[model samples]
Target chain A: AQSVAQPEDQVNVAEGNPLTVKCTYSVSGNPYLFWYVQYPNRGLQFLLKYITGDNLVKGSYGFEAEFNKSQTSFHLKKPSALVSDSALYFCAVRDGKDIFGKGTRLHILP
Target chain B: GAGVSQTPSNKVTEKGKYVELRCDPISGHTALYWYRQSLGQGPEFLIYFQGTGAADDSGLPNDRFFAVRPEGSVSTLKIQRTERGDSAVYLCASSPGVGPLYGYTFGSGTRLTVV
Candidate 1:
């Protein structure tokens, strides 16, 4: 079965600092990975996706993710984090089916 | 264009009652999906529709949970004999096609509370 793993339950970073949220997946075929952000009381918002071609994919809100095929990883990153950037981040992978990670709560301390 | 929209932003019902949640997908979107999200977990896929047909209903927990897209544009999820465990935020999303790269656009979601 295809599955996604988000190692951290929460990540704390200071405002204006770089942020990183790790994600890894296990799938049988070529993986299609995605990153989504959810604010309080709202549904998941699409941030970015890695389907084919480029390993480094840029997305909304200055977010970017690197898809590493060998390590089965697609970690989300931002150059400088803002306080408003804090939210729940989810990494998902598409096998034959779409499977989501447990989710990582991000806190940007000002 | 407007994003996906769901009706009844919040619904509270007694256990054993029935409830229906509605979803209107983006204009011209061919694929729609339904998911359930708990307090702290990621959304769990419940079903998927391609046009007017249900292409994947495997994620549905049981027969008590059912969904229909009669016109291939709007969809409804009906839950029978709702239990306390069924309380969660129900989300609806739409995509242009089956490709995962097309990433889904989600609605604000309906918060269902079973008393």
Candidate 2:
């Protein structure tokens, strides 16, 4: 079985400050990691993914995630946080199929 | 369609009633997937279809839940008996192939409410 976990139920960050949303996973073999954001009453939107090559992968909306092999972690990061970035963040792992974490609510306070 | 489209943005039904949710994937997408999202939770995979054949249906909860994609262009999820526990947002996504790297595009989702 494969699973992903977002340890924090919520993450609070001040506007213009850097933000980090933690994620970890347990899966067999090499894993494909993904980060998605969801707004109220909307579907998940792709943020970034780690397939191969570089440990750090850049994605849409000025977001990026680092794939740490030893730590089995893929944490989403943004150089500067924006109030509009507040939403639910999900970390998912894909081995044979996709497995998603419970989700972490990101709050950017101005 | 330019993006994945799901019909009936919101549906309210009484318990024990049968409900059908439809999904129209982006044109030319060969793979389609169905998932259920409950309050405060992530989307749970229900089924996956490759073309006209179902490649994976193991995620489905039980026999009461079924899905079909005859032409592989559009898919419908059918529930035999609706329950309050079944109330949640059902999401539909389409990918060009079977890989997370491709990043499947998702629809707004169908909000199902069983009273």
**Which DockQ values do the candidates obtain, in the order shown?**
0.72, 0.73
Per-model C-alpha lDDT, please? 0.92, 0.91
Best by TM-score: 2
Question: What digit string (tens of lDDT, one per residue) describes model 1 on residues A1-110?
Answer: 88899999999999999999999999888788999999887778999999999999999999999999989899999999999998999999875346789899999999
Cα deviation at A81, candidate 2, in Å, is 0.4
How do the residues A4-108 of candidate 2 rate in per-residue lDDT, one tens digit apiece? 999999999999999999999898888899998998767789888898999999999999999998999999999999999999999988754577899999999
Which number leads on lDDT? 1
* Candidate 2 lDDT tens digits, B1-115: 9999999999999999999999999999999999999989989999999898889898999888999999979999999889998999999999888876578789999999999
Interface RMSD of each: 1.5, 1.3
Local distance difference test, candidate 1: 0.92
Worst 10 residues of 1 chain A by lDDT: A93-102
Residue lDDT tens for model 1, B1-115: 4999999999999999999999999999999999999988888989999999999899999998999999999999999999999999999999998877588899999999999
